[model samples]
Target: MHMIENGNVAAALGVRRCRVNVIAAYPITPQTPLTERLSEYVEAGEMKAEYIPVESEHSALAVCIAASSAGSRVFTATSANGLLYMHEQVQWASGARLPIVMCVVNRAVGAPWNVWNDQQDSISQRDTGWIQIYCSDHQQIIDTVIKAYWIAEKVSIPIMVCYDGYILSHTYMPFDLPDQDKVDAFLPPFKPDYALNPDEPASLNTVTLPDVRVDVRGELAHGYMEIRYLLQEELRKTLAVAAEAEKRFGDIFGREGDPYLESYRTSDADYIAVGLGSLTYQLRVSVDALRKEGIKVGILGVRFYRPFPDEAVASALKGKKAVIVFEKALSYGYEGALASDLKSALYEHLAGTGALPAVQNYILGIGGREIHTDHLTQALRAAIQGSISKEPVWIGLKL
Candidate 1:
């Protein structure tokens, strides 16, 4: 079915179609409408799930953690300060290996109190052990939520589906809605490897000594270091799981997206613009206009942030003359997180090739500031023509 909907509604519908068992959330801007729609679905009997209204984001994820521990499929949404408030629980959920999926409406964290589109909030939590997938539009938002559950369940890790607040979250678009039967066929019912069971009660997340210990059954049990290592190993599995999920989703829906990075016109281009989220869509427009004007420009959209697609990124950007990173979030004194990661990936890949592209980072749209195509075009032109310095360029800043 084809319908006109915004990112929030698209996400809610995706969760509903997945037949989520529990949804626990606290209301926050941009993200609120998503959960609000889920609540309405539960109320109207359209979705058979428990909608738990919590007082804070911490409590909201706590409810999801508890439900997921009991072998229930769960979901929630948060933004900005609300996400920060759940920081501790976010780590807990991933540490516990709960397959909980969440929608994060990307917003600027407040020191000055702004409620607009910014990627800093989510980018700040990049090391929280969750698989972060950024969406460029309503279609990707809907599709990613469904794939997130599949990937999370497969790897027994939490997934964060992020989209720019107000930009993708509130903006309306036309997208194809996948049939429930087809989705059911593509994704199997989640069967967790471990869960809280009364009949088979066992200690979970118990404190372990420094060394490995023997269990009652004379089996070796993992120590703290071992457990941490296992978590890292499982996270690595997400790379393959994400790729498989995208392939299957594409085979079923016919709208395939690259699991790690989406390359556009980069095959024969000399300069490439790199970024994530809805801003990438705008950057694509800039790329096209520049290409028409005889500038060999392209775009590389970073889709998966965690378990970064190092090899794919290196391959796509290997021969490019320059790669400009346009980001909404920055790492303060250094470049943006994505830019830093890209540089590292490029360096590692080009170690043997002995060739490298001039990488530049342009921090833009911070605190919900508007970034127009003209700004991107000029920056791309400057980078391509070697007019801009290697230092981070702060776009739209008042001199």
Candidate 2:
């Protein structure tokens, strides 16, 4: 089925098709519409699930945590301060290893109180133990929601599906909605390995002593270090699981892109522009325009930020003269988060090759500031000509 819809509606429809058992949400800008749609689905008998309306974002995620521990497939959405408010619970859910899926409508965190598209809210929480998947458009939004549940349940790690607020969240686009039966076939019901059962009771997230101890069966029980180590290991496993999910989803739905890093015309290009989310779409247009003007430019879109796709990114950007990173969020005194990660990935993997590309970071669209192809084109041109300074460039800045 094909229909014209915004990203919020697309996400709701995807969750409904997944047969989610519980939805606990607190309404926040941009993200509110998604929860609203889900509520309508539940009320109209279109979806057989409980729509939990919580008073605050903290409670919303807390409800999801409780539901998920009880063997239910749970979901929720939030943006900006709402996400910040749920920071503690976010860590709790991942620490408990609940496969709870969340939609973070990327919005600018407040100081001057702006409510528009910015990736700061989600990027700030990158250290949390969740699989972060950034979507470029409405189609990816729906598809990623279904894929997230599959990946999360497979690895027992929570997943965060992020997209630009207002830019992708409210913008309308025509996307093909996969048939419910096909989605059902692609993604089976989530069966957790362990749950809160009265008959088969087990202690969860119990306090651990600093050192490991022997259990009743003479097996060593995990200490704090061991538990954290296992969490890191599980996060590493998500790289492979994400790839498999993308492959299987494509086989069933016929829509496919690189689940890690998507490269366009990067094979032989001298210059490349790299970024994540809806900004990648604008960068692609700029790449085309630059190519027509005889500039050897391409694009590398970072789809999966958590796993970082280090090896793949290094390979794609090996021979390029310069790789310019466009980002909407900055890491305060340091470079943009995505740019810093890319630099580290290249340095760690390509140090032996001695042919690392010159990398640059340009912060744009922060606090809902507008971005256009011309702005990106100018930045790419400067990067290619070696005119951009070593420090990060701020696009659309009045000063």
Q: Model 2: what TM-score?
A: 0.98
Model 1, span 1-399: residue lDDT tens: 999999999999999889999999999997989999999999999999999989899999999999999999999999999999999999999989999999999999989899988899999999989999999989898899999999999888999999999999998999989999989988788888877899999887888999999998999998888878888888887888888998999898888878998788987899989999888889888899998998888899999999788888999988788999999998878889999999999999996685688898899998888898899888888888886565799999988
lDDT of candidate 2 over 193-271, digit per residue (tens): 8889999888788888999989767999999889888989989878988889989998999988789987888877998
Clashing pairs in 2: none
Model 2 residue 278 distance off true place after TM-score fit, in angstroms: 0.5
Candidate 1 CA-lDDT value: 0.91
TM-score of each candidate? 0.98, 0.98
Model 2 has how many clashing residue pairs? 0
lDDT of 2 at 119: 94
